[model samples]
Target chain A: MLTIENLYVSINGTPLLEGINLSIGDGETVILFGPNGSGKTTLLYTIMGIGGYEVTEGRILFNDEDITHIPAYERSRKGIGMSMQRPPSIHGLKTRGLVEMCAGKRTVDVEALAKKVNLESFLDRDINLGFSGGEIKRSEILQLMAQRPKLLLFDEPESGVDVENMALVGNMARELLEGPSEPDAQHTLHDLMHERKTSGLIITHTGHILDYITADRGHVLYSGHLCCADNPKRILDHLKKYGYKECIRCLS
Target chain B: MKVDLSKYEFTGHASEKVDDLTRLDKGEKESMKMAGFDASEKNRSASFVQIDHNHAFCKSYDPGVEILPLGLALKIHEGWGDLKWKLLKPEKDEFTRLAADSTHGGYVIRVKKGAKLTAPIQSCLMMHTNKVGQNVHNIILVEEGAEAHILSGCTTTLADQTAAHIGISEFYVEKNASLTFTMIHNWGENVEVRPRSAGQVETGGIFLSNYVSLKPVKNLQMYPAITLKGAGSIARFNSVIVSTENTFMDVGNRVILDAADTRTEIISHAIASGGHIIARGHIQANCSPAKGHLECQGLLLNNGIIQAIPELDGRMEGVELSHEAAVGKIAKEELEYLMIRGMDEEEASSAIVRGFLNIDIMGLPPELKTEIDKAITESEKSMF
Candidate 1:
């Protein structure tokens, strides 16, 4: 479970996210719908404890504990993982090496993970260096799958991903939410699928994510304010029909 | 049939021909003599061989080898005579000044064409007095398709004294030949070293020189050049200099590409602590389709100074030239990360420094690489 009470974030003394309040229950997926510059990234970075974003006046509670000042790596070690929108290219650090590092296990079967994510050919290459857009996205997913965090944050995962790999990524996302059913099997196809206790908060602007997985609830974030929380299909259809103009008008 | 110049102001009168006939003036007769052909004694052609006053104590470990001081005739008669050494001096005016005051120990080494010499040609110059001076000349002529590896080292044993060591080494890599020249210098704290070395490579030849300095002297000024004159020739220069304790080092390396499809590469590394180092590297591609590359990197440990200047000059439009120079201290994150991984601060720092220096040494021969690694490790232990 995650909770934020009156979160305020600013960059260079300019307010980006003002008086934001939200919460997510256990095993629940929350979709954050907002237009450009609506503090979506700032909010995600604030929750993930990145970007050096100062929490002017707010408290972030994770699993009923105050973790507002936790560092990124510590937060990651505490069952919190984030898939960045644009990951940094780390030279000489192989993808498998990073997976093993983040997994914190020397005996991790990296070859299997690579094969699962279709990155088996590039396992020995540098981490995300010269990888295509889709390959980078898949690498992010592979890292998340290895981390197996309790609360996952996806920052625009749909951006720049081609249609051919979108289904595989979408299915992987679905499988990560469900628990692994058969643990004794050699290949853990259902391992990520059976892990049902994991929750996620996805940020999307195009609303094309509605075709992939079932979002439990949707919240419209406009002008640094959470206007309303409703059904995912209803909100996505409303945004598709009227855009953010109507949402801003409703806020006024 | 020659006209006299009565109105001209001659700086110095031309001397008579002495025991050395290899120092003929720039003319057809000199060319013929350089090609090992006998000249007509009837014409009485004049030769200018200006021998210096400083005597070179000559001795050879092998009985078949001959070591001469600074005479060109003894050098030629002993089968060490090749025309390449004559062209290494500066112009006439500059050559005279250097020759008159230069203390040169001239050694001629001749490996027959296709002959392989396993033993390195070793030489040493001892500056035993304060304000001592040394100018050593070494000529190594590897005939066509021959191969050899020469190891030359210079050092000073005494302390609290000022000394100068100027060595001029000329190497001729003939057609289809290969040569590796490794020069290591560990001068004392008060010695000043000015080494001007040059080498010329003929067609299908390879010349590689690796220069490394561990200790810091008072001053070091070196400009070593290699000219690739024949097509498909290659020249490579790898140099590393470390200075500390108020030392000043000025090092330069240049490679000239004169024939088509020639290739040249130069890599320099400088590490300074409580001193200053100036490294200049240049690669000039004058012929079409030639390739030139230059890389110079410096690491400053303490408040000492480092100046890296790398230049690439291309005259032909079809040539490729690239140059890169970086000067900075060790990265803090990398240092901290290495420290956290069970290495002490000194160990971590030395590891970082060794990594920086051994980057180019990675692709060297295994034996040479092991020697370099051992040398750096010993130096690092001594520094700590």
Candidate 2:
């Protein structure tokens, strides 16, 4: 559903992501593991079409359509949604109001979606205003659920979330990748195999989100380059045995 | 410097336009609807409508509420009314004398003691004659233990007519009474308006004022004052003004907390687009245990001028006073945030401007609040 080829991104003429090639297939979940200053967020923002992240070289194609020069809002309109590591605090914009706008002619049950993220109590408050760390994460997930985008980009979703909220956030993110949930007593196992799926590219630092989500593949980004692509659990075990530097040294 | 009213002195006889009490033309009726004065006549009690120098209509639909002409009210309440006009709006300059002398007619709205009015008293004042100076003197009184709401609107019939409106208003809230006053203005591009007002809140009384001016004007200057004279009284002033074209405005509110445990709050939101605006707020806490806060925020849509002056004075040892003022163009972060939510640049900026102008004042009728929101939205649309 998403493709990038030799993509070089820069901010204000300073190259951040150089010679990068990545892609996420339909219904596939990919985990991106990178250390600090490794341009993980820069890649996400560049793909999301956020301004100030200039694409110096190469192209980005989503669902066979070139979205290299599209604006951020238009990118959202094309079914690309992101959860930021640090979202801004909008003083007068209510969370419910923003979610309603994101729904955009779709009769989505906002209150039910907010309840899934444990943010029902904060639906009426200003967006991200006076919210705790965990609350902010949950609020971001709430908006994503409301958006129901085709390609979901999760940035540090498990960084500040607590264990209790982590379970809820993790469940919601899993539900986003898998199909919607349904409790049934009379259902064949084949019915479960026929569930619809969604595409997701999640960026994780602590990899704690791996406890709840099953990824098809994992890639390590180091020093503005993709270093390795392997099994999700094996790469994690390799990094656990040896730190990021040792992994980068071995890859080099 | 004292204001010289020499050039503003247009004392010639007004054109002989017959006052039609029973007739409202299409344009005049549309103006009234725009001002939120098109409610059913049966829905209104103690209603009045004034166009230029004519007292178009005045009627009382309830016994507890009385509406009368200013001249007749002064004559009837000569001994009992709160007509100490000079004490509140002292004839300190030529402009004051001009308004007091050339005044045609105004409304004197009074609610009897212990009266709880369910419906608001509505008043519509408009300028229809070109080059006519429409001066009015208004007085409102709420007797002890009474509760009332007043909605007053001022507008102009023509967009380019040259006119001037000078009004002097005095309000009195007795002990345990509460009054909510809302004023909306829609003036022409060449009109000048000066509305001088003051209020005195007695012990345990409350006075709330909401003022909005969302139309172009040649020049407008007003500084209304309110004093909490008795113990435990409360006063609040909230205003939103949007100036467009070549309009110039100098508006402010002053509050004095003189009794023990009294509280006052002054808030204003000013928007200037291709115009000049100087928003001023002043608050003084004079007695022990008194509290006051003043906030003024200005949004400049262009290179047009905007100045916010906030002054706070605390005299007594236990008095607490604070002021916060800000004036700037729209923030890029705020604009981009809205864009991320799917609005274009123009839509995002206008939404922020509208939200900035939205002040949550308490105790307004839902219908009135809707009207006020509609007016603000209309002004926001004209900004871009």
TM-score of chain B of each: 0.76, 0.92
Badly placed stretches (over 4 Å) of model 1 are A1-3, A22-52, A61-73, A76-131, A134-243, B1-197, B201-223, B232-252, B263-279, B291-306, B316-361, B365-384
Cα misplacement distance, residue B340 of candidate 1 (Å): 16
lDDT, candidate 2, residue B314? 83
Please provide, for model 2 over B127-155, each residue's C-alpha lDDT reduced to its tens digit, 9 standing for 90 to 100: 88777778787889899999988888888
Predicted model with the maximum DockQ: 2
Q: Report the first chain's TM-score for all candidates.
A: 0.92, 0.94
Candidate 1 colliding pairs = A178-A193, A178-A194, A178-A195, A179-A193, A179-A194, A179-A195, A179-A196, A180-A194, A180-A195
The interface root-mean-square deviation of each model, in the order shown, is 7.7, 1.9
Error of 2 at B328 (Å): 3.1
Q: Is the docking of candidate 2 incorrect, acceptable, medium or high quality?
A: acceptable
* Tens digits of per-residue lDDT for model 2, A1-252: 999999998888888998999989887889998889999988988888775788989999999899999877787778888887778776456788878877766878988988888788998787888988788888877787777888889998888788888887887888777755564676555565465456889998778888888789999988789878898788888878786977567657
Question: Candidate 2 has which clashing residue pairs, if any?
Answer: none
The clash number for model 1 is 9
Worst 10 residues of 2 chain B by lDDT: B13-22
Tens digit of per-residue lDDT, candidate 1, span B1-384: 111222221222222323333343334233222211222322221111122223323333333233444465354575455443564664433322453354344455555688655544443344444555555566677779877665555645455656666667788889988887767676678776767677889999999888777776888777778899999999988887778867899897989999998998898878887678888988888998899888888878777689887888899899999988878887654443333222345755775677566534423334445655666776675445
